[model samples]
Target: MSKNSSTATGTSVSSRILLDAVTKHYPGQSKPAVDGITLEIPAGKIVMLVGPSGCGKTTTLKMINRLIEPTEGRITLGDEDVTNIDGDQLRRRMGYVIQAGGLFPHMTVAANIAIVPKMLGWSKEKIKNRVDELLELVSLEPAMYRDRYPRELSGGQQQRVGVARALAADPPVLLMDEPFGAVDPITRQRLQDELLRIQEEVQKTIVFVTHDFDEAVKLGDWIVVFSEGAHIVQYDTPERILNEPASSFVEDFIGAGAGLKQLTLNRVRDVELAEAVTGSPGEMAQDVLARVKEAGDGHAVILDENRRPLSWPSRRQLSRLETIPATPDAAIPLVTQGSTLSDALDTMLVSSAGAALVTDRRRSFVGVITVEVVMEAITRSRKASAMANDNDSPVGTNTGTIEVQGGTT
Candidate 1:
């Protein structure tokens, strides 16, 4: 498997989650809210529960941590039977994030993240270090944001803090319920990209619930399509779910342009980025233009003192200037290697040069992703998906069902 690929095993500090014949029936309802469902969430992999409104996806997620008690069946985490465990104790071992961050307006960012650790009786010094570490992990500078109240932060920033709080105790499992649904489209995309990047580092077992099918395709290693009453419409990888719909219900749920959706499966690192002529700020524009001409390139990427991208100027723009500008261009399009091809394409579409700059984890410029590269990636992905669907080899199959035996699955 690739570095970004999801598997059953890795260097995960997490445990697998299993639900066997789990059902949740309401007090007075004629039918159960969540019918009998059996599912296995692999260690360190993200499993997404997706369906229309009124479906039991959210109910199923809450039952894992016993936020809502299950009327029947077993819930196991690793080797332990947690179905009947103390609800408060069980919840402390898992991280949960909900819509709009669910932050308390009165608390500062550091205090918010320190809730779980403090409840666990961690020392003040330890909690402080943890808060700073988590804040940095979520791409927020600790010193600046830690002292601010939740009401002072933007919607996306508040969501990042919520995630930080959930991971405060370094729990083995994470449960998210439409965590990014409340944000604007652009911020939502950034949050998705940030989540993927963070998952690469933490590798926790994440069970996410969303009504958006496209969100499921982008974030989930395994997707569980749920019908009304929480029936398992299809439990499979995103690739299989898109290429081979189990029923007409799934086909309509996927809606139009299944081929276009395949672009979400691949990442920017999967393709070879085109190299651009690079120069530093305060460097002679004539020298940089010479290198651009020698390389047969139309643009040159300007770098700051730390080797971070500052601007991407064309040959024409460079010819009129004597030296590269010291100030960074706020409008420069940027994407990280972990970003999906779909996101890279979106960034490039709004760029005047029809390309986006590729950055490393440190935000340093690596290369350029052009429209042609994205188009080629989309084409290759379509062909690969088609070929996989035609073959009977079961190469990419991931049936999320595990047989329970001896109190374990």
Candidate 2:
């Protein structure tokens, strides 16, 4: 059977998901798999549940959509109790994703993404439009991938399709359980970055479960750290969790260098980027070199007509050569304004350029990010973290339920 699209209308609506004293127990098990756990997942934000294996993290997540019913306590979607709701109906209101995409082996990618919309009786034209939108949302080109089966795609591509499927219905809430766990480390990191990018636009209340603290820190707006038996050790923002662990249990769980980890929260836009010499194709090599020398960076970034980055010209080509190469086609890495300092560092390292061109949403040139710039931002953030009060209240705990209102593509 093919997966179904979400039945939710394609609107940007979200509700604060609440788990009040949530507990789960097996028939023969003496102790509860998930002990008394009360946590508030704010609307339109990512809440990560992280801990060791068998820590009940996954069980807690499943309980939200009632995939695995809790033996005691109430789960609320906004102000409505989910425990008393119809299982099928409740699931239709939320999107669920698991490891390895969990796509139907027999279905094409478009079919998998359209399943929920079709089940909800969406018109063929509407479903088709949504399939294309979601594929683009997840960075999968719709025209290229819509007809492909799961077997034909790589693990990362399949995971993207799975994400596209989950978002097909535009559900207000999304539950992900180790969704990127099965991919290679590099692919996993890219997925994490992509997820953050998607969240910025969709703003669904996301509950993500992962064992990797790094992933948790990277993606979580707020994090709930679970100990043995699903007991909560700490529930707070990523910054608070990194800067101030609630207890020794939390401190131990978070491990060392918490401050360093906090750098991921700081974005490239937060720091001052250095001005770089820039030129367009067909510019005189002598002119470009003169500008580069004036800027004292000894390098020039060439831009296209749309102001998007093209390549970094070699200092040798500029300083000792003739007119700029007519077919300038060298590789230069790029980072967006929303890119975190950690992401910038990764780009620099991978590109071996020690610097990356930063751009805005319109793909226009913004500035450049270097390792030194990232380091400065981190140093400033660390000092701020040190002076910040650990007792300050966390973000997104404003109320039991947040009323989210916006438009959805």
- Quote each prediction's TM-score: 0.88, 0.81
Candidate 1 worst ten-residue window by lDDT: 1-10
Score each candidate by Cα lDDT. 0.85, 0.78
Residue-level lDDT tens digits of model 2 in 271-376: 8887888888877888898888877786888888988787777678777767655464545677777767787888888888888888875557898888888777
Assess candidate 1 and give its lDDT. Answer: 0.85
Error of 1 at 40 (Å): 1.4
lDDT of each residue in 10-32, candidate 1, tens digit only: 23324888777888999999988
